[model samples]
Target: MSMNPITFTPIGVIHSPHKSKEGTPIQPSRLQRSSGEVEIFSEFRPGLRDLEGFSKIFLIFHLHAMQESQLEVTPYLDDQTRGVFATRAPSRPNPIGLSLVDLFSIDNGILKVGGLDILDGTPLLDIKPFIPDIDHAEGIKVGWLEDKTHHFRNHQADDRF
Candidate 1:
């Protein structure tokens, strides 16, 4: 087997109220009222055309603040340690984060979004329009998260990761 290193250039920066890992909302669904900005670089501004038609967008970003990677971690909603992939833990081999946020408006190269759970200064990797017809599904299983979803609404991030 062989592996190759992969690199990606950030398309923009995510500006959010969360300056620190502690107390930040763990997921976008948990922070619906929060607002933030995604400032796309000038080179990528042309890609923003027709994006306004969507009510929501998916933001894929790098977890820039992650200090280390862990194979297992105690997630915010659970007391038991779980595999990194089973939980939405920041400290992972790739450290990528994704969130679906409300697209409030787009002015110039800046996109005003709501329900932002990402941290400030996080590097934006990509943005995709959220299409409910394609993105949403019915009768899905959440695995370990199924029992924990009920308590997630009030959960905020701590500095564990």
Candidate 2:
């Protein structure tokens, strides 16, 4: 298939305590109780209607800080080098990032979220409600990550890319 270039206008920005990726948690699951704010642009405020009801929301953002792309990466949880698509390394062709965070409340055009693992001032591309009935799966195969997730809570991101 032919590849096509796509442009995305960020609708918002993410605000968190993490100023750099070096010490940031690699995933939301690694940072319990972490809090952050999502400030939706005024023009997109209307799209957030009824979003407060959801317990979790998927924050799709751009990895604007990723300076380069890599095809193979040594994942944070593993020592083996693997294809970039198989890992969640920030360096990618598109540099798009996604995280499922706990939705606390929506006040005005800002949303309070928990367990966020994104960097401060990250561009927010989109937000979607997470429904367990449709998003969660049973007997899911994690491939190489099967037995390596036990220590995610203590792992921190480094300047590997």
Candidate 3:
């Protein structure tokens, strides 16, 4: 096998109230219901044509604030050190992040979204409609997070990573 560097041009920018990772939510929270805007670049505005119909969307963006990567990390919700792949730590080999947000409206190239957990000025990679029939699952296990998720609502970004 061979490895090659891959490059991507950001499609847009994510504008949110989260200016720093220190206080940003680790993930999108339906309870918090924070609202923000996704500004798609002019060249990508055509892709937003049918996006308004989606009630929710998945925002794929670069974790630009990450300082480094760790193979093992103490996840925000737990004290045990675990493999990075087992947790959603921002400092990863690729530093990519995903958020499922409620889509309220789209005007021109700006998208109004709720439940945003991403930091402001984050580079948007892609956006996909969240089709419940396709994205929802059953009989799933969350590993270490199974017991830690109850504290999700109270968890916020810290300087651990």
How close is each model in CA RMSD to the real structure? 1.3, 1.3, 1.0
Which residue segments of model 2 deviate by more than 4 Å? none
Per-residue lDDT value at 107 in model 1: 98
Which pairs clash (backbone N, Cα, C closer than 3 Å) in model 2?
none
List per-prediction Cα lDDT, in the order shown.
0.90, 0.90, 0.90
Ten-residue stretch with the least lDDT total in model 1: 25-34
On residues 1-161, what C-alpha lDDT tens digit does candidate 1 reach at each position?
A: 86998899999999999898998888886344779899999999999999999988999999999989999999888889999999888899999998988998999999999888889999999999998889999999998898778665666798788
What tens digits encode model 2's per-residue C-alpha lDDT throughout 1-161?
Answer: 97789999999999998999988888896245669899999999999999989989999999999999999989898889999998888999999999999998999999999887799999999999999999999998888888887777767798886
lDDT by residue for model 3 over 3-96, one digit each (tens)?
9999999999999998888888888987877799999999999988988889989999999989899999998988889999999898899999
Name the TM-score of candidate 1.
0.95
* Candidate that scores best on TM-score: 3
Position 2, candidate 1: lDDT: 68
Q: Cα lDDT of model 2 overall? A: 0.90
Give the worst 10-residue stretch by lDDT in candidate 2: 25-34
Backbone clash pairs for candidate 1 read none
Candidate 2, residue 27: lDDT: 88
In angstroms, give how far residue 3 of model 1 lies from its true place. Answer: 1.4
